[model samples]
Target: MTRSELVTALAQRFPQLQTNDTGLSVNVILERMAEALTHGDRIEKRGFGSFKINFRLPRTGRNPKTGQCVQVPAKAVPHFKPGKELRDRVG
Candidate 1:
């Protein structure tokens, strides 16, 4: 779900929290997760999934429009692995 949808769901599930508070909480959580990932730290939620960074080595790629070969620079990218419980539940 989108951020707004998640905030709404949390607000609905917890009547004690205000919508704005829930929104702020979600924002804080997402910001912290991003910060952790930026620092090359792994994030794992049991029965849910894990997130980590993966490196892609530099490679040659072709431009789709011009069909021209280009050098692609290496970089780090985020990756997610679903937990067994999550995979089984989804299946």
Candidate 2:
């Protein structure tokens, strides 16, 4: 689901919280996660999953369209590994 859907669901689940408050809560949670990722920190939520950064080395890749060699720059990407609880639930 999208961000707005999550906000709506959170607001519904916690009737004591206002929509604006719920929105802020959701935004804060997302912002914190982003900040952690930006610092190369890993996040692990019990029964959910773990998020970490993976580094890809620069490499030469072939262009499928023109069959020409291309240089691909190195980059750090986010990776997610599901927890056992989540995997079990899905399975």
Candidate 3:
């Protein structure tokens, strides 16, 4: 589900929590996660998954349309590794 959908679900699930409060709570959690990733930190949630960054070294890449060679810059990308419980549940 989308972010708004998640907030709505949380609000519905917890009747004591107002919709606004639920929305803020969700936003805070997501913002913290993003902030941690931005700082090159890893977040591991047991029974769920681990979030980390993978670095890609500079390399040559080709343009699909013209097949032109291009230099690709180094970059860090967010990566996720599912925990065993999550993997088993999905499977």
State the C-alpha lDDT per candidate: 0.98, 0.97, 0.98
Tens digits of per-residue lDDT, candidate 2, 2-91, equal 999999999999999999999999999999999999999999999999999999999999999999999999999999999999999999
TM-score each candidate.
Answer: 0.96, 0.97, 0.97
Model 3, runs deviating above 4 Å: none
**Per-residue lDDT of 35-76 in model 1, one digit per residue for the tens?**
999999999999999999999999999999999999999999
Candidates arranged by TM-score, highest first: 2, 3, 1
Off by over 4 Å in 1: none
**lDDT of candidate 3 over 2-89, digit per residue (tens):** 9999999999999999999999999999999999999999999999999999999999999999999999999999999999999999
Scored against the true structure, residue 63 in model 1 reaches a CA lDDT of: 100
* Pairs that collide, model 2: none
Worst 10 residues of 1 by lDDT: 29-38
Name the runs in model 2 displaced over 4 angstroms. none
